[model samples]
Target: MATLYQLHSSMDKLRRSTEQMAQTWRAGDSIILLGATAAFIDWLNAYLEDNDIDRIASIYALADDVAQLGDHTNAKLNLNTKLTAVLSDTEWVTLTQDPQFDKVVTIAL
Candidate 1:
């Protein structure tokens, strides 16, 4: 089964301490959600830019969440250009129900 981890406004934690991220995610199978923090895109972009081995499989972010970022243009461009699968908030429930993802883990930063 696929493992799903929710970073509740704690993306910075993953940047500083990658143990949890590494434990739950495996490279391209991972999804990026624009949490409450604006730094999420920066951190994610930096990581993706610096590391070629770990490619983002998909991204799930509400339109409002993406708008909160100061540089939504670049962020949106990055996500759209890099990922083929982009899900909205409503689709999260459907994804969770998928047989592929049976385990949903919520991690707070």
Candidate 2:
């Protein structure tokens, strides 16, 4: 049987490993994430190759721009500004078709 001290040490190691994996994933450091998921490394490689990094980066950059605009100002506090941010450049029909959007509106209310 394993001693309590041995169990504690194993748990600590697991915690450290999981934390490291999460950090690497959040940082978009694909190399470390791929190493951690050794079995899925091939899938990761193929997925990355098939995906459009430039398009993804531009989308995230736009989201960051919106967030920055909302920050350092009372834009978020203003109902009109919030609506404009959420609806600007978005088709009303498309926005209405999103199922999750109702939940967002409910939460806002």
Candidate 3:
């Protein structure tokens, strides 16, 4: 079990790493690597929350763009799922309730 101090230190390190990755992303660096860095920051934030650490704000501040990229990717995936005929009717109905799917369908029709 990590002590509070250790948890804080880990979060700080993750925050710093995320900041450096964000700078690299801004300079037209490898997006795939930047996306992975953002995911790492998100995982760190979830870990901090699980351990009762107050570091959500810092994590978000350091990786907001990466988080946005994740959100966009998810939205696109959801849209593709809805358009594809892979899901059953029940699944399709459930997906229709999703905002991303609903938006895509509304625009298509």
Candidate 4:
């Protein structure tokens, strides 16, 4: 298979998985977004509001990704995100090892 085709397929699968998660969102479902997944936030928020679904959303984002998006609003873009800039591999492994964080149905990173 062509590299471009594989990339597209992977992206399509990711989008579908994310959309399904958003659709069936529950109160305690916290999102650990890796890479640059900020664009989905607005849509997810709107979907929750429009459906009258309430969730205590804890969004974890990489500080570097937000910076790469440009500091247009002086970091206001990360107002709702828990930014982690210097977390090591071991730190992440430890954090995700919590039993409560085991509901990981889809990982896009």
Candidate 5:
């Protein structure tokens, strides 16, 4: 499994390249890039959902950090929202089953 750090670094690179391409105003190319980025985000969301308990905790902690960044954060660009947006309400409810680190998970949720 790819670590979150690796995913972030790769996504950052993809965004920079996509931004550069968008600057050129080539409509077709820009659309392709947009689709690719969306697909990548979907893959990431699935990965997070399928990860083990420890990894899920790590992801939640990461999300909490973003939430802590305050109200100035953009809804479109917020990592926590992006990450959690993939989860269904039912999936979220299941997370409470793990007895360990209940406090951390609750705070993250």
Candidate 6:
């Protein structure tokens, strides 16, 4: 299980490389890289969801990225939506009980 710092560092590197590639107007390559980035983000999202970290560091990172990208409103909305979902007791319990997610929450917390 990766720490929050490790996940953040990985995301930052990916974003920087993706941005650099996009600046060259290489549409196909940029698209491919962006797709890979999105996949990585989705993996993080699922990991957070399963570990009950959706309301913790993951949302903070996501919101920060959204704000840095000049999408404040969408970022706020996304954070609110994910937090709301995570607040449901049943959902929270289910997530916390998942064996695959146990280590991340323990390490992250």
Cα lDDT over the full model 1: 0.55
On a 0 to 100 scale, what is the lDDT of residue 53 in model 2? Answer: 18
* Clashing pairs in model 3, backbone N/Cα/C closer than 3 A: none
Pairs of residues at least 3 apart in sequence or in different chains that clash in candidate 6: none
Best by TM-score: 1
Tens digits of per-residue lDDT for model 6, 29-56: 1011111132245545554344333223
- Candidate 5 Cα deviation (angstroms), residue 100: 3.7
Q: On residues 49-89, what C-alpha lDDT tens digit does candidate 1 reach at each position?
A: 55442544555665566566557564655755553444667
Worst 10 residues of 4 by lDDT: 1-10
Model 4, 9-46: lDDT tens digits are: 13334555445555556666555445455434455455
Better of 1 and 2 by TM-score: 1
lDDT of 2 at 82: 20
RMSD list, candidates in order: 3.8, 18.4, 17.5, 8.6, 15.2, 13.7
lDDT of every model, 2 decimals: 0.55, 0.26, 0.32, 0.46, 0.32, 0.33
Per-residue lDDT for 75 in model 5? 53
lDDT of 5 at 6: 15
Query: How do all models score by TM-score?
Result: 0.61, 0.19, 0.22, 0.54, 0.22, 0.24
**CA error at residue 2 for candidate 2, angstroms:** 43
Residue runs of model 1 more than 4 Å from their true location after superposition: 10-12, 37-39, 45-56, 70-77
The candidate maximizing lDDT is: 1
Give per-residue lDDT, candidate 2, residue 17: 37
| Deviation (Å) of 63 in candidate 5 | 14
Better of 3 and 4 by lDDT: 4
lDDT string, candidate 3, 1-109, tens digits: 1110111123345654434333222221111112233334445545434544442211111233334546776465342332222334454345445443212111000
TM match of model 3 to true structure:
0.22
Which lDDT value does model 6 have at 39?
Answer: 26
